[model samples]
Target: MKSIFRLLFFVIGLSLVNAQEIATTDATTPDGVGFKSKNEFYIFGDAVVIGNNILSKDDKKAFNVLQVNNDDTKMRYVDIDRDPTTFSSSQAALKLPSDFKKIVYAGLYWSATYAYEKGSRKQQKGNYVYKGSGARSKIVNQIKFSLPNQEYQDITGEVIYDGLGSPTHLINSPYVCYADVTKLLKEAEVKSGAYTVANIKATQGYLSGGSAGGWMMYVVYQSPTDNPKYISTYHGFALVNKEEPLDITFENFKSVEKGDVKTSVVVSVLEGDSDLRGDEFAIIKQRDGSFQSLSNGARFQQNFFNSSITNNSIKNRDRLPNSENTFGFDIAKLDIPNYNNTIINNSTSETTLRLKTEADRFYLYFTAFQTEIEQTYFDDIIQDNNPNASVTAYVSPEIVRAQPESDPSYNTKEKRKAYKYTKRSLNSKAFKYLKNKKSAAIAGIEGGYYVISGVFSESLRADKWTTKLIENGLDANAFINPKNNWNYIYLLRSDTAEEAFELTEELKTNYRYRDTWVLKANLD
Candidate 1:
């Protein structure tokens, strides 16, 4: 029976709440978490970095960093125009706050177009051109500081920059050059009153006579709090197939800032063969310090039902076997206050954690943040099998996303949606005339049990997933049962039990829903 359960688990993966106001594509999972499309890390709330909303094209969109390299000051609130030769006198800087706010990351957005002005070879009249080298290579730009008058350094390290294609080949290319200047900002003292921020002012020696070329620095700041929580996921768990342990490194993830306290650690294990005691995972402080067990109040793992696979177990038989195991627990046993907890330490928080596998292989996920600081997905926007969100230069608190229907086709998927939605001003006369313009189907949903993908406890999450399914042209619904405390996110419903069962089987085998099951309850 257990083997049957394992097989089912292997064939079908686990799931979670798909909240409304979401999108297609994977959210920016920190480099550590192996789990993609499941977890995320972002600021708790929204913030404005450099509200540059000054462009006729794509004007409504907010940009923390804007480069008026086209020599158009109308495109930015604080435009820094300069030629390469005037570096000494043509530098620009923004003063930031010295309070709890910290610059998490920074980037330079690249954008340039050819002007009617003559070039050396030809008089290109209004033709478009690209910035940076033609190839997908690194272009280093100078950024200086004003607080202590420090020296300039070339921004380098694990940065993700997008590539805009050649001038003629690409129509829409939103590319950014990423850089992290956290260490430099942390050590620099704010000038007498303001944050002596970055110097993102420079130019190409050849952008002469109105030929556009400029640079903008996108600054990301995190406002500190009395209690800051952090959540993170790790990748590369599949690389280890045997019963070997993997190190959970914190160096790459910016979870722990200065002056933090040790909090709880939740270790999630997916597709494993065995159960885990809360003690299997340990937090090792420093390189040689003692290992601390965080399993204070451990919740034993719960086994979910897999209908695709059946076994000889009397209660559940005749179906395909389900063999997958999923479990997670909080570190409740360790005396966090007694020792210097690396996860909660005020200085140099947890460097690494050790996770031992129960069997041959499994995927591990964890989020460790200090008090009040919790982990979350970026604005509830996630993607599965979709293009990734482009790397934007400026960092905001979180993203604002619309929910997806069951099919979850991208907004770009024109065929899936019935109509195209365009943003219009509230004051527009057409909006008033078309305010009541909404279309409805000729018929309503049929009655019967719903063959659902997953049941969620959160109504918001259930509704979110339902929207995605609906957008995909599926008859998805989020049925709530207050008495049973169930929120079923169903894909399709039928009038008869036999039909529902057949549909469930079809979904399991044909629709990639190996664990799809039927759900029925009283409407009243």
Candidate 2:
């Protein structure tokens, strides 16, 4: 009787232990703790499968199913059995059947949180966050990859620009823009290794270890609107920083004077290790008339190539395009306390500056990982398969301004006396129709809109007295040396000159621009 009782107790205790282990395991495993990382560094989210039927009508009539074997049927068949693995690269994408309609986008969620510990100046021991055993430490600079293809990869790093604090910046990875829903889901799935399943199953995973570790998982969903080109679909857990304010000064983007408009200034630090020179550091000037040290941040290691210099005509300076420099150094961040501005000792404030000339130029704080980007079909594939179908792609931004020209002749018969003040009356009429026409857009050689500078020249004496008007604050060069072929014009993008003339009657100051032949500027 004693032996029998002992055996029964032993069986019950083992069963209880087994049940406890199974309860804590992920959905996919009865006793397994989590999915293993394919590469040495990181684990991926579970793979998800999603597809929708594409139905096509024979004609555009109310009810037309006249032909059973038409273009619509062929399109539906093509969409039914698409191989997600085919569109695995950064730019790889698949096409949706044109005859078929209705796309269902599906994704997966693979979330796991862990304790995060960050090194700090105040604590010699360092600060730490407590998390459950399954939690993962945050990863700042790490590599991320998609399944089935090994050639394509991205480095994930933190971007702390705009004084918005810090957010994940996945730089240097190839980006994709596609309209197909099936292609996006395929790129967002995990599809390699031992714990593979025939169909995607819900699973709990543990992701821990790193400076700012936490749990994470893969999540998938469909977009309500038709995904436009140049847009991206992304999902992941990350830290959100405070929003940074922007101040627009005419010094670069516009022609307005400093202190003319009250705006919040902020600096956006670009992440990368490109060649930077001492002159680039001078770009940021403090109020006390001191320059920030050029070698203040971490020394970056370059993995790419040699250095080359070119004259950046757009910014009116010679600089490296691929190199890293202070990108957005707005004045607003300086005004705020406990933000970007810092008071050193008793007299000066120090602010770290950052920049990127081109989109590819990134500053080096940590390794940049292309965690995820929009997935799309390759340009050649989309064009070959469907000639009429258009694939949206991301393009670079270009500056559109008046091209420089040769010096104006200024050799009129009476160089100094042409279009002399003809008792002109600078009144409300000078800016009569202009107040309502404050803004206008023009056709650009590049893809985006180009705002034309307003040209104000007396139609009768356009060529004459243009120099005098230019001295009084008009872009004489734009009219004199235009890429579109025009000489002897006075242009203004702001209301400064026009406003000055309109108020001439009230002040009677400046000796009378009213008599100086004023006319509304016609912007082209």
Name the top TM-score candidate.
1
**Candidate 1 global Cα RMSD:** 27.5
Instruction: After the best TM-score superposition of candidate 2, give how far the Cα of residue 312 lies from its true spot, in angstroms.
Output: 33
Candidate 1: global Cα-lDDT? 0.31
Model 1 bad stretches (over 4 Å): 1-48, 51-148, 157-175, 191-524
What TM-score would you give candidate 2 relative to the actual structure?
0.17
Candidate 1 structure, TM-score to reference: 0.25
What is the Å distance of residue 205 in model 2 from its true position? 14
Question: Candidate 2, residues 1-524: lDDT per residue as tens digits?
Answer: 00000000000100000111111112321111121111100001111121110111211112122122111121111111133532111111122222211222322121111122111122235643323222222332332333233332342432111111122322111110112123433454332221111111100111111111011112122121111111111211111111221111111011112112111221212111123221122113334534332221122112110011111111101111111211110001122121233211111212223222222222211110001111122211111121222121111111111111121112212233222222225354434433333222222222211112222223334444455556666444333213223232323233444543433333222332322222223342
Candidate 1 C-alpha lDDT tens digits along 203-270: 22222222222222334344432222333322221222234545554431233344445444333232
List clash counts for every candidate, in order: 57, 55
